[model samples]
Structure formats: C-alpha cells, structure tokens
Target: MTAGSRHSVSVAGVVVDDQGRALLIQRRDNGHWEAPGGVLELDEDILTGLRREVEEETGLQVTPTALTGVYKNMPRGIVALVFRCRAEAGSLRESDESSAFRWVTAEEVAKLADEAFAIRVQDALAQHLTAPIRQHDGLRILG
Candidate 1:
C-alpha cells in the first residue's frame, strides 16, 4: 500500500441458487441491493477474491463458475471483475458490511437493485447470459 495507491482489487459475482435466482445484498452503508462482492488483497487470484467476497458478504459458500465481464471504473477508480458463481453451502444472512441478503429472481433483481448498483447487477447478468451489447459507451459505475 502506498500513500496514493488504492491498494485493492475487487472481485464481485452474481451468485445463483437452485432455482436460478441471483443473490443480492443490502449494503449497510450504501443501502443498495447488489450482487455479493468485495476487494482483493494483494496476491490473491481473482476467483479467490470473488469467492472470499461472496462468503464474507453473504455467509454463503460459493464456487466461481465463469468470468462474466470486467469493468474498469475511472477517477476514484476500480477495476471491477465479475463472475458467475453458485452457492453450495450456508444459509443467507447479513454480515458486518450488509444489513440483509436474499435470493432474488433475475426479473426481480432488475427491479429491486437500488439504482446505482443496479447497473452492475444488470451488466453482470447480461454478460453471464451472453446477451448482445447494447452499447460500447462504457458503463459509468458508482457504488
């Protein structure tokens, strides 16, 4: 870590349950419904970070299935790496960073995610589903 360095690389995932529902977290500070994710410590592989983040934020054991999409945010920036994952263990519960967690259907996620973070969930799903790109204007993401 350095004085001006961001010091972290975050890996987030769209986690699915048995019924093909997405897991969403209600962040304590932001109050947004988002897919489970967090930062990568130095030296950690992206998948390791993604799994670790999902576990920490949702208390659910997850396995990374595939890379969905990667977004490079700017300014107060971050390289947001996303993945497709599935929960294989533990029950849903809030952790230190979140107030609540739930498995919401794909349709429900599109509606429930509080505006700002909703785009990421939508983008991740689009990539997971390998849908066609609507624009290459670049996603302006904010947490």
Candidate 2:
C-alpha cells in the first residue's frame, strides 16, 4: 500500500419483496437512486453494518439472506458487499440520508441507477448460487 493510500469497506442491502421488487433509495446528498447502504463502522460486523445501514436509510429492518455481489469502486478505493435481504419489520419512512424510497422491478432499476449501482440490484434479483465479484468506477462497469 502507498504511504497515504487507504481503503474503506461498505455494505449494501437489496431488500426484495415477494413480488420481486427491490427497495431503492434516492440519496439525500447526491439525489442518486441506489440500494440502501453505507460505510461500515470499524467496530461492527459486516452483517450488522448491512442491517444498520438498510434500517437507517429505509426505515426497514432487514435480514440479509445471501450475499449477491462484491464490488469495488476502482477510482475511489471503496469495496462494497451487496446482499439479498428480506424485510423483517418496520414501515418505510424517509430519513436524513434518503430523500425518497421506492420498490422497483429489474427494468426500473436499470432506468433509475447507473450501471455500477444497477448491477448490485440485478445480482440480488438473480439469486445465483455463487456471488459475483465486480469492479467499477463508481458509475460504470470496468472493462
């Protein structure tokens, strides 16, 4: 690692309902629609971080069912672990970090999010036996 180089780990949850719609959030800071997630705290476990992030953003208690994808923001040095989650409890409410919320299908996800974010939702929907590892530049997939 370079002297000043650092990396952060983040977690995202694709909370899917029985109707096959995934929960998406419009970020308060960026106005970008994406899955509910955030950076992990140093003292928390991955699953805990995932649940906390999802709840904080969407006001839903989520239980991660399976890991869907692992993504890296190549330019920003942020590694994100995306999981397929089930809503356990709580009602949807707008929060400080999330300005809007919606339950969207696959097609809607593509139109709402950039490729980098869309891929995470797609992977969760797919529910493949194995998780995929992908790299992106925070907006688009890397070649």
Candidate 3:
C-alpha cells in the first residue's frame, strides 16, 4: 500500500425473502436506494458487521447465507463484501441512515438502484460456485 493511501472495508447484505425479492433501503443521506450496510468496524468479524449494519439500517435481523460478491469502488478506495442473507427476525423500521425500505424483485432492483449497487443484489440472487469480484466508480460498474 502506498503511504497515506488506505482502503476501507464495508459489508452489505441483500436480504432475500421467500418470494424471491431483495430488500433495499432508501438512504437518508442521498435518497438513493441500495442494500443496507456500512463500514465494518475494526473490532468486528465479517458476519457480525453484516448483521449489525443490516439491522441498524432496516431493523431486520439477517443471517448471511452466502458470500455473493466483492466490489471495489476504485475512486473511493472502498472494498465491499456483499452477502445473500435471509431475514431471520425483527420488523422493518426506518433509521437515521435509511428513510424507507422496499422488498423488490430483480427487475425493480435494476430500476431503483445504481448499476454498481444493483449488480451486488443480482449477484447474490444468482447461483455461483464462487464469489464474483467487481470494480466500480461509485455509480457504474467497470470492466
């Protein structure tokens, strides 16, 4: 790593329901719809961070079932670990980070979220032998 250059790790969970829909949160900060997650704490493990972030933003307890994808926002130096999760418990509530929530199908996800964020949900829903690694520039996925 170069001096003064560091990468931050974030964890996001795409909570899938029995109806094959993924849960998305409308971020209060930007009003953009995306998965519920945030920067992982230094003291916490991956799953712990995933559960905490999802719960904090959506008020739903989630159990991560698969590691779906790893995405890097090249411009921001943020690497995000995305997971396919099942809602284990709790009711949905709005939080400071999220203003609203929606359970959307794959088609709706594409329309509601940015390309970079929508792909993470799509990857989680697909069946993959291994997690996919991707790069983005905050809004668009890169080649």
**Clash count, candidate 1:** 0
In Å, residue 45's CA in model 2 sits off its true spot by: 0.6
Taking all chains together, each candidate's TM-score versus the true structure is: 0.77, 0.97, 0.96
Summarize candidate 1's per-residue lDDT along 1-143 as a digit string, tens digits. Answer: 67676634567888866666677889998787888888788888877778788888888888877676665545544666777787788877878888987777766876887544555566655554562222122333434
RMSD of each: 4.2, 0.9, 1.0
For model 1, the superposed segments whose C-alpha errors exceed 4 Å read: 1-8, 114-116, 126-143
Q: Find the 10 residues in a row with the least total lDDT in model 2.
A: 1-10
- Candidate 2's residue-wise lDDT over 1-143, tens digit each? 88558999999999999999999999999999999999999999999999999999988999999999999999899999999999989999999999998899989999999999999999999888899999999899998
Model 1 residue 121 lDDT score:
60
Give the Å shift of residue 90 in candidate 2.
Answer: 0.4
Write down the lDDT that model 1 would get. 0.70
- Local lDDT at 28 for model 3: 96
lDDT of 3 by residue, 4-71 (tens): 59999999999999998999999999999999999999999999999999999999999999999999
TM-score of 3: 0.96
